[model samples]
Target: MDNKEYIASGILELYVAGSLSEKENEEVSALIQENPELLAEVISIEKAIVQLTAAAKKDATYSFNDIKNQLKDTETKVITFPKPNRKQYIGWAAAFILGSTLLLSVLQNNSLKEQLSAEKQQLEEQINKSSNSLADAEKLIEVFRDKDIISIPLAGQTVSPTSYAKVYWDKKTNSIYLDAKGLPEPPEGKVYQVWSLTLDPLTPTSLGVLDTFTADVNKIFTISNANQSEAFGITLEPAGGSLSPNLEQLYTLGAVAS
Candidate 1:
């Protein structure tokens, strides 16, 4: 099945929930590695599950500590009875009530503890995401500051008048860091493909496809480009990309400076 059909099959949700069999899990894992869009979908499903779990935990109505304190503050009254049988019956009733209260208190406390633990886990995850984002920003700043990096600005083309993107090419490393933050998300079953162009012959070579555009938080992707490219262009194509550039779908283009 195609990536779009596979993603819409609801199997990713089951995979995230750990309901799939081991063999199925392995198959999904292999597919995720081969397809960026599938991996993105899986990650999205997992994040949704985490958010729902956190919300349910937050909605817990009772506080275990508060209930415990209230029980402790309650005053107990004792009365002397003229009949021994009546006194004995009252004592038994009191014991039964006390037992039920303690049992309930224990159960509630356990539930509260579980909720508290879940909240803590969610907090940790948020902190980690923040830290990772900060690290990425710092790394990008360093790349931009490098003296050897070539910055190329790709302007919008006829197909997309408002879309724009930038390329940071590191010739020393034979790689390019594409900043596509200004481009719109590709429609389902479509992806943006990058091309390395040699203007002398006007030949185009495929660099790679951005299949994870919808899932990428920063819209920046790293692709290997060892070609002696004189220009760069981005075109929207069907998922998995096209063998050759489709000029009709060209969204952005920029030429390298001498």
Candidate 2:
């Protein structure tokens, strides 16, 4: 169970108030030991209640002392019966103090709950991102391990000397996985277009264009290529791919090794 959710449930408040069942109290106690923040919250709640109770007692004592002083000033002899008005005043004063303290506790609990909720949301987001990254890594690993997959290393061309990419082709599936991690992001209104080349007459077949190059984190793309490809080349083209290979803008090229 999520510790943040448990804390936000307001069970900790009830635990401090001694309103939870014995079993529930034990569970809360165990949780507190595991989470220092939760334990701190419980301690704060308890401390606030204790301080309020102490302040109320001190105020009541002071009021009683003031009453005794006033009575002695008015008359030298002691009263025969206890003063009812004094008792009524003390009762009302204690009730008011208790109500205020209860109100403060409620507000504090709500504030803490809101903070816990925000923290929980942030934690969940981080977990989701981590899970997605792990899934992507696993998929890449599987692609690399396939025996039938032809691994082609495309070297950088004159346009981008440092740019490089790898193509993992599964001939049975007629699909290629392009790992473009080494390629630089295309400029605005431009994208990378991949081609399956037949070197005989140097004819190029459009495999597909990478529209999500900038957005893709791993820069891995899947493209279908049923052609008996002799070589693979990538070029920087307009948003939509050109009909023919733009040899001048070629970024990377590699031939299938016999």
Candidate 3:
């Protein structure tokens, strides 16, 4: 029989209880010797039984040594007499009580194991979340420390007096990291659009719409801009970005440093 199947058959409980026949006992001992897991299972079962037995009898202490001694002893024989004494009846009653207690202990042990396993899984999930958060913080720190990056602060405009944002432009990569944490969440059916402006002709180029406005945790967006941008502006537009920014709906604007 498969070792797992044998272990799960409740045979280990009987072996620990010293209820198995001599031949069956030898077979289990050989299996336990070969498989460390099986040996561990047997030891756990034995310990639970001993604890249950000891708890059942307040005055008695049941140790592994006592259990081993009992296992080595020959099977008990029932001898018939003309009259059975009260001692024999009391002994039989005690055996039934101990058996019931052992069953309950086994059930409680299984429940505790299940609870421990669930807690272990929850701990692992928390560890993974913490690791991801740390990685994101490290990456953001690197972006701030880069030598080729320039910070441009965008102040609130007439449309939204409290709104503000920042743009970190990386000259070497021609990429801009838009930090819009201070901006209010967009309204229904409306999105925030970013623009790269040229002051000479007052031209505006649509960088892109902030599609994941509400879901983005960092509120930081990356957009490629190779233009000779003199200023940057943000406006509230329709679902998809507008061809040209609406001057009336412009929320924030900042001019590039000369």
| Highest-TM-score candidate | 1
Clashing pairs in 2: none
Indicate the residue-level lDDT of 202 in model 1. 92
Candidate 3 structure quality by residue, lDDT tens digits, 40-109: 9999998888888767776766579867845754776453434436678767767766877698789989
* Candidates arranged by TM-score, highest first: 1, 2, 3
TM-score of 2: 0.61
Q: Single out the weakest 10-residue window by summed lDDT for candidate 2.
A: 75-84
- Listed per candidate, the RMSD to the true structure in angstroms reads 20.9, 24.1, 22.1
Show where candidate 1 strays beyond 4 Å: 1-85
Count the clashes in each prediction.
Answer: 0, 0, 0
List the pairs of residues colliding in candidate 1.
none
For model 2, the superposed segments whose C-alpha errors exceed 4 Å read: 1-94
What lDDT tens digits, residue by residue, belong to model 2 across residues 4-115?
Answer: 7877888988998899999999988998998899999899989998887787664333457667735644555432433447667778667766887799789989989998
TM-score of each: 0.64, 0.61, 0.59
**Which of candidates 1 and 2 is the stronger one according to TM-score?**
1
Q: Which stretch of 10 consecutive residues in model 3 shows the poorest summed lDDT?
A: 76-85
- In order, candidate lDDTs are 0.92, 0.90, 0.90
- Residues 127-219, model 1: lDDT tens digits: 999999999999999999999999999999999999999999999999999999999989999999999999977999999999989999889
